[model samples]
Target: MQLEEPQLKPRDYVVVASMLFGLFFGAGNLIFPLHLGQIAGANWLPATLGFLVTAVVLPLLSVLAISATHAEGVYDIGRPLGKWFALTFMVLIHATIGPLFGTPRTATVAFTTGIAPMLPKQWSSAGLLVFSALFFLAAFLLSYKERKITSAIGKVLNPTFLLLLAVVFFVGFLHPFGAPSSAPVTAHYQQAGLLNGFLQGYNTMDALAGLAFGVTVVTAVRGLGLKRDRTVSAVTAKAGVLATAAIGLVYVLLILLGAMSTNYFTASAEGGTAFNQIITYYFGAAGHALLATMLTVTCLTTAVGLVAAFAQDFHKHFPKVSYTAWLAMMSFASFLTANFGLETIIQWSTPMLMFLYPLAMVLIGLSTTSAWFHRAPVVYGFVVAFTVVPALMDMVAAFPAVISKSAVGLAVTHLRDYLPFATVGLGWLVPALIGLALGLTVYAVQQRQHAGAQEME
Candidate 1:
């Protein structure tokens, strides 16, 4: 007789949900929505809805997709794409979320929002360097034990982060700076508010993180004594839903705060700066301390989670290196990158994200719906191939002005003119759909041929 695995209780579910929320919510989460609200102006409602689709809904779906597929990690999620593709995709996702961009970003955001405002002008650069070192050191120590990440973040850091944000939300909302401006919406936001908001939400990069973080979530679920795949997936899905709800609520509140502050403040070029200004406006000197503490804690939790996830995944692939070594190495790299500052990181990352987001979305979409096509490899390959063209176009479009003005950029621009939804950064959607149709048709014909051959033999 087979033994049944135990299920998580309600309280356990809350803990897991909080852990997922902490993992997903970080520096981008803090800055993007606020900026969206400021730019969206009177159209903030529709914009917020659009942002929620990619930021909250897709990320939640990513977690469920991983659960449904029983994927051990992103590599497992991409396995139907073949070994080479799977390995490459997994490496890119991990590196983006780990030391290359996302991890370093957490430290930069913390410094800008928390530490920089308090420092004298001359001291800011040195302060950032020192701050980054300490930040990554703490992250390295915290992430040294992967097994403890869930409890450490979910029970301790998450609640503390929430409490701080709650104070900011309560004070800001209760004492409004000013109503949302009746001023004209930004040029891009005026008409295509939903599309622009959707694109902006991609900056959060949670969907990609979702693929990598799923392993940690699954491991944590099993650690709680749930052994069956069905039970584990069910718990993971429920936890994901709960976490998304929390994240959505926070985003809405932040957007509202941003909208209300629009009249009193001119938008800063950087969202982090605008956010810092909002807190200072309402809470005065004390607000700086509050914002600083909140930013540091939230960024720290996210850094630890990302580093832990990356190290755990890489360690599985290269057991000889050990998890501790990978963790230390990633922490060092992130520290080095963080000193480059937030704006430079964002500029450098945008083009890469333009390419990667669509591919990540396609993989997540296929993983969730794989059962419908009987897990056909051709289906995965075709869709990914079709998606790449538009993704590359988006990368060119997002390239720096100097590059975009070059011969290759001019060629890409002309090509993009013919692609559907190219202007909205969704040129990949049509190709992806067509690829799915062709792949399914080819798969059906091949199956029929194989069946007929077997019968004749």
Candidate 2:
């Protein structure tokens, strides 16, 4: 009995996998690849590969990192860096993924991108209010009990989402819009399809979602009877593999759908438009049958997951507040933000995402390698210190044009232009590498000093 590590049943794995998939595959996930296929056009294959790197692979690694570190959540992920940093980073992360913005954005994205066009023009504002209220209410209900999250999402919600989406995928591919192989390419894609595709994947901000969602998945694993961190991590990794694999498959289908639509429609300004047009073409007047349901399900699943995660983590840290209270607060905050402040929410969020993604990626990378440096604070401090400046610059660059034109923003923007790969959105790469090397050198020197002291004693 001692030899046995408590294990989850195979069914549990599927349910957990479904839950994780539900959390990660939100509205943005749906739209991005479809748009990628349109722009990549004939270059769809390479573009798909690039998209998979960030959207599929990075998210999976995020789960693995948390598991491997045996860390409770994002807070633990940064704990080696000291309490203040870890707390600050965790707050920023949860805030980004929580009610203030990301959570609400999911609701607004579904309504604005999918449902709004179908409504009478005069109903837009009222429509948003009503829709957002209902959306947040449903999300709050689904996430009401933390223990029930896995089953509520995996058994009930996720399968429904897939079934609804599958109807479109089946009919669209079976009849065919046309091969994307010869689709006319966008000019930039013609010049740099692969690179452009990678950047698009980066822009999806799945890396942030990955970091934020880590707590949810970890908690879910613990709820399922795995007591040891090792056992929990293993199960979590298995579930993550299943989840990301499912996500990757879905992305391919959506991208193909976009690519093939070249025969029937020009690429619209955004994936939401492309998706809407394709549904309209496929199902005609009954288009909302698939469109509204599918988009809503995707966004709702994400909202449930994020809200549940926020409540759990906050309750853990701020024990004075009950979990249920946190849940209610998040839902209410999301409700108000979704209806009245969505545009403002998006403007602020883009800059925040621009700032945090590089830092999150660096942290994820460092955590995955935590054992090598023994989870040293110096290593984390150095890497993050170097990455923060460029990430801040990216944040400034992503600000609204009105703000970006200001003197302070212009100065930062001018300085960023001198950083390599800034235009490609990876100006932090080189600096991070330099930090890693210096940190290792310092670490080695410290190790030698400790060894010599021990030897003399």
Candidate 3:
């Protein structure tokens, strides 16, 4: 039987954007930016802007690139670099954002805001474990199928999530705040306000979700009857722009609210704990509870999406497992990890992302420029080689301070002579640039050889 297709028009981009925003804006979207502003204090304005560039702009562009390229997923998007490279990139991204890190984070955040405060001092940790278990069980149930009912529920709840956040921000702002706190004594970093804020924003992992989101956006566009590749690409780009704009606006508001909170509250608490205090101080305990409920609901939707996305990807790669089986496996894994709590989950995720993100960025760059090299394997090989080594070095360096610090200083010092940009956190940049140069040189050589052979023929 032939199923009817959606003939999506330009106007549907709004709906697409709304859906994308709902998918992208999860737990970190709520509190992390707030903490950034509080940390930046009077420097909040510049810091927030810096955060938006990486946190907001990069993810949106990634979505647009996915659509324009007509890739199956992020791995497909990186196919210009060869199939195996794409597969490795996919594994790393999924591990970071899937069962290992981002999935569990949802339950952790939900528990911190929704259940932790209500617990007595001694039983706090136990309460958190119980809440996360229950939360994932609910998410697992919600994601038991890839059906209309679940999608409809998510669409409905997405708006409520936004509304609750808006309420919290407005209420917090209306109450007068005191002067901003001074910077931490140990705070020594570049773009101090901006760079640190940018890295912190990475916790959102929206860029990782760009791959999952591209699939949904493409499906939605096709459902609207825009099945033509070019049209789908254009529509996805438009929708992504709309979604990013909404996210940037919300981030700005949250950061401002966080900065303002410092006037009335101390900066001593963890961002998560301080967040609850800020809301409760403004609108009372009832408001805090309401916002916490909203956060849990939002995380629930995100968890559902992540589960389904991972299942879809895994089923595609390993059809023998079946989608149902894959979903169950991922859900169980996420459920178990959620017990570790949000703080630990986030702490562990950082080094993984630091190592993997450079590789991901290399793929994104190559994919975006695939047209220039005619999707040649030579370019892919050079770029992958250039990126992988530095990334591995980064992972190795991110370990026990005493051992890695002493060992890495000497290793990096010696390695710097041969490795380009070894000093920058972006050690891959110089190598990637060299790869681009070599790729162009090799392409030129190949083109000349072809011309000579043609003349002989």
Candidate 4:
């Protein structure tokens, strides 16, 4: 009764995978690993491993989980929870990775690292405004047609971006930046290097991006004429592996470059600054030009992906609002917010990310393991409810002054002592596990009871 769509060839798989890599490899991806290497110093090995776990492993798993569910979008992945909960979570993710923080950071990072260094100090602010305006305008135009994102990013932008990075990698690898210094480890990296690295990886926010971008990957796969859910899932899984490999290779090389260059370059407050310093140290003025081009292209690709995803998701929910209108609004908001600069945007985003990351991880875990639970709504509800407790605590901890002097703050502080990993910013781990176990128990009991009732009838 139904026609099966033609399967995509191996080359198509590589193209889609490259597109996914471009989407994930943005400003944060470029900066974070390099910073981790600089700070991790002698502990770079363990730190890099930990960074890979959260930055690469978790994000890849998220894509696989979404594909497993045959989700239409991030909202669909959350549907097992409830309609309202799915809507709320999806909206928060899109907003966080769209106009509020992610999109703006892309433009600001590009300007700060790529363009600002070339300009005079006094011209920085004005330069940013003009650059971000043009940046978002370009992203807006590229993202106008969601259907063509793969071709634009995969076929065009990704190759150029990779070529630029390859230049940096080749030069940095061939010419040693005065061997990696045996520098003193930073506070977090001194003892708990792995944990610190894991936490630092969270700064990339790629896992959240993975959830949001899964729809784009799915669409790309479908476009290649793969229609069956199982076939799509397999293709998505392979593509995720390829993308993960690409990003992982880049991260490792960047981390190594950062570590080696620590002695040559002074410590910078921002990762982008450190990265720019490394490039300049290796290749002089020409390196600056290369870094500028690499960052701009990578950031533009990321911005296009985020804007397209946000517009598509919102337009789906509110059919009356055209995708073009949503894209225009988001691009404008991102442009305005980019003027705030990277540091300020990061500061504002911390509390929100503190709350959202744990919940998103839990959802991803549940979705990945859903086959074991038969997609029970109660399991989703209970797990999320329990996960929220620690997530809220994390939010408060993120902004201690908001409740520091209050009774609630005192109570939360006291409760922290009882929570494992609370001191390391992962206070939610134990609670999430407990929630999963309890939800499973309850689900099992209910299923048994229903079976018994059916036999009695």
| TM-score (C-alpha) between model 1 and the true structure | 0.97
Measured against the true structure, the TM-scores of the candidates, in listed sequence, are 0.97, 0.96, 0.88, 0.96
The segments of candidate 1 whose C-alpha lies over 4 angstroms from its true place after superposition are 181-184, 453-457
What digit string (tens of lDDT, one per residue) describes model 3 on residues 202-314? 67888777876565566656656665677778778888888899999999887777777777676634567667877677768685678678788778777777777777777
Which portions of model 3 miss their true places by more than 4 Å?
1-11, 147-150, 176-186, 189-191, 223-226, 400-424
Give the clashing pairs for model 1.
none
Query: lDDT by residue for model 1 over 1-457, one digit each (tens)?
Result: 6657765579999999999999999978998999988888778888998999999988987998888898878898889978888889999998887788999999999898788989998998999999999999998898777778888889999999999888888888888877765633677778888888898889898999999898789888888888878888889999999999999999998887777777788766667877999888878999889888989989988898888888888888889999999889999999999999888888878888889899999889888898888789999988999999889988888888888779999889789868898888888899999998889899999999999999999
Comparing candidate 1 with candidate 2, which one achieves the higher lDDT? 1
**lDDT score of model 4?**
0.87
Clashing pairs in 3: 6-223, 6-224, 6-225, 7-224, 7-225, 8-224, 8-225, 178-263
The C-alpha RMSD in Å for every predicted model, in order, reads 1.5, 1.6, 3.3, 1.7
**Model 2 regions lying over 4 Å from their true place:** 1-6, 341-344
Q: For model 4, name the residue pairs that clash.
A: none
